[model samples]
Target: MIDRVRRFNRTVTQRIGALNDAFLSSDRSLGQARLLWEIGPQGCDVRLLRSRLDLNSGYLSRLLRSLKDDGLVVVEQSGTDGRVRTAHLTDHGLTERAMLDRRSDDAAASILAPLSVRQRTQLITAMIEVERLLVASTVLVTACNPRHPDARSCLRAYFSELSHRFDGGFDPTRSISADEEELTPPAGLLLVASLHSEPVGCGAVKFHDDARAEIKRMWVAPTVRGLGLGRRLLADLEVHAAANRIRTLRLETNRALDEAIGLYRAVGYHEVLAFNDEPYADYWFEKTLDRSTAPAPNLPDREH
Candidate 1:
């Protein structure tokens, strides 16, 4: 598997001219050119650029410095926040970026033009699958404090989505509570799934004295759905529950949440009688945990 990955990486880099000093025949290296493209027309936050590119601060700074030296880009402190910096392209830089775009299109065309129509279709289809899997692999799921900014963001989005999807519109106060205090350690823990260091999904498990745990706030951003993230979050939550000696895990969901219900059933959960009077719930699920074979609960607390 490792060899296959290495071979794929080598092939992609070579095919895309990633090893060239001047990518797409531009005057900048592949890294610099890609950075320029990421900066785009409206500009972007320096911190965001670093996170999205998975580049260290110093390396990103070096690339920005080179662009600045070439008079192709300008870095400025945000007026709204002195601590926040943004990178923008100069007029010359925009022109160069346009040229690079054309060149890149031509380069891609060169690759596709050599293949027959069927071969081109096959290559494109394979590329799409590869990109999807690569994206899925980058998502990092970790134990996060419910009070953390990312966790809070996910909760807010989750509630907002529920409000929109529910029949009478959802209200947290009227539903079963899974507050900050409840999600903290010893009581329970929240697992946040992040892509590019930004929270995209979250799930929480609340423990009880009787070796039972309840899943709460399980959600994944719409943009990141179909990546198997919901299943991943549920599996991790189950692992945490089992490691803590929990013998049973349960959750309740609204009938409107068909996807969540389907996921529960697909993952060995069984429909059960009302476990609790959750007003929004129309279905309840319970799962028996095999603690003897449960994986250790050593999920990371930072970017993976």
Candidate 2:
């Protein structure tokens, strides 16, 4: 598998001119060109650029410095927040960026020009699948404090979504609680899934007497729903449960959430009698965990 991946990487890099000292036959390396393009005419936050490009601070700063030296980019403290820095393209930078775009388009055309129509279609279809899987591979799931900003973000979005989807709206106050105290260590744990440093999903499990746990706050952002993030989060939660010696895992959900209900059933949970009076719940599910032999759900490695 590793050999195949290395072969694919080699082919892609060569085909895309990633191995070239001057990408797109330009004077800048691939990293410099990408940073320049990302910092569009309107500019971008330096921090955001780093996050989006997944570059270390020093490396990103070095790229910005190179661009600055060439009189193509400017880095300045944001007027609204002096602590924040923004990267903007100069007139020359914009000209260079436009040239880069033209070159990039031509390069793509050159690659496709050699292929037959059917081959082109197949290649593109394969590219789409590869890109989707690559994005999925970048998702990171790890234990998180419920009160942390990312966890809070997911919870707020989760409630807002529920309010819109549930009949007559929804109220957290009326629903069963999965408060910070309950979700913290010794009681429960929350898992937050992030992609490119932005929280995209979250799930929590409340441990009860080391034998049972209740799943709560299962949610995937609408934009990332089709990426199987919810499943990944649930699998991680299950692993945590098994490690903690939990014998059974259970959850309740509103009928309006058809997808969530389907996920629960597909993952071995079976419908059961109402376990609790969750005001919004219309279905309950439970899954017995076999500590001795149940295999963990297959999941992609968490992004670092």
Candidate 3:
């Protein structure tokens, strides 16, 4: 099994230019090249980049220093909040990034050059699957504001999906209002998962300053439903609540959401009496997130 996995990795790496020393040989390491690409034209929050890359603070700081020393990027304090820093590529860095993009295209073309038409089509299909899986692997779950654009986007998508799934359809205007300030730090949190630039799933925890917390708006994109995104979102929300000293998590779901009910039960949530009079809720659940065991695995992406 290990050998097979290794072989698969080797094939993918070779095809994706991962083995190419010249891929970004101009001056930067692969990590730095990736950082440059992630920085983008609008720049990015340094803290966000760290979270997105899952890099240690010290290591990320070193990479930033290296880029700054090379005159390839600039880091500046946010004008609105001096404590927050943003990273932007310099003009030279932009030029280098463009070159990297071209190199990426060239590498892709190189991979296709040796393939017959049928083989090329098969390869592209496989590549898409691999890309989707890789994206599924990299998603991180953490506290967020429900009002954050990405979080809102995920909620909207979730509602849209429900509208299609429900016999009577759904309407966000009729759904419970999720206040932005309530979802901000201390009061509550929203967690969103994304693949590349697209929001794929979301969940929220609302803390009442009392011992109990409420879980709300749990959802995963239909395209990624089987990837375990729902479970990941649930587990992450529990963790966030626990960290806030919340002891119990309560949730309500519609009868139409049988899968969600099953997920909650399988993950240790118990049937509970109605906690709130949500017009849409037909089932209620409560769970105490036990930190004694390892948290549930992050959701895998739906396989094509």
Candidate 2's residue-wise lDDT over 1-304, tens digit each? 9999999998998877543323537878879998988898899999999988999999999999999999999999999999889999999999999988877777778889999999999999999999999898898887888878998999999999999999999999988888999998779988898887799999999999859999999999987878888888888888888887898999999899999999999988999999998888999999998677746634443322
Q: Estimate each model's TM-score.
A: 0.89, 0.88, 0.57
After superposition, the stretches of candidate 1 with alpha carbons farther than 4 Å from their true spots are: 18-24, 29-35, 46-71, 74-77, 82-85
Winner on lDDT (1 vs 2): 1
Between which residue pairs do clashes occur in model 1? none
Least accurate 10 contiguous residues by lDDT in model 2:
295-304
Please report, in order, the local distance difference test score of every candidate based on alpha carbons.
Answer: 0.90, 0.88, 0.79
- Return whichever of 1 and 2 wins on TM-score: 1
lDDT of 1 by residue, 13-36 (tens): 888764332353776787899899
Model 2: residues >4 Å from true position, as ranges? Answer: 18-24, 29-31, 50-71, 74-77, 295-304
Each model's backbone clash number: 0, 0, 1
Model 1 alpha-carbon miss at residue 248, Å: 0.8
Q: How many angstroms is residue 116 displaced in model 3 relative to the true structure, after the best TM-score fit?
A: 18
lDDT of 3 by residue, 124-236 (tens): 89878877766667776655567567887887787887888777988766766667777676777778787765778888877886889888788887777677778878877
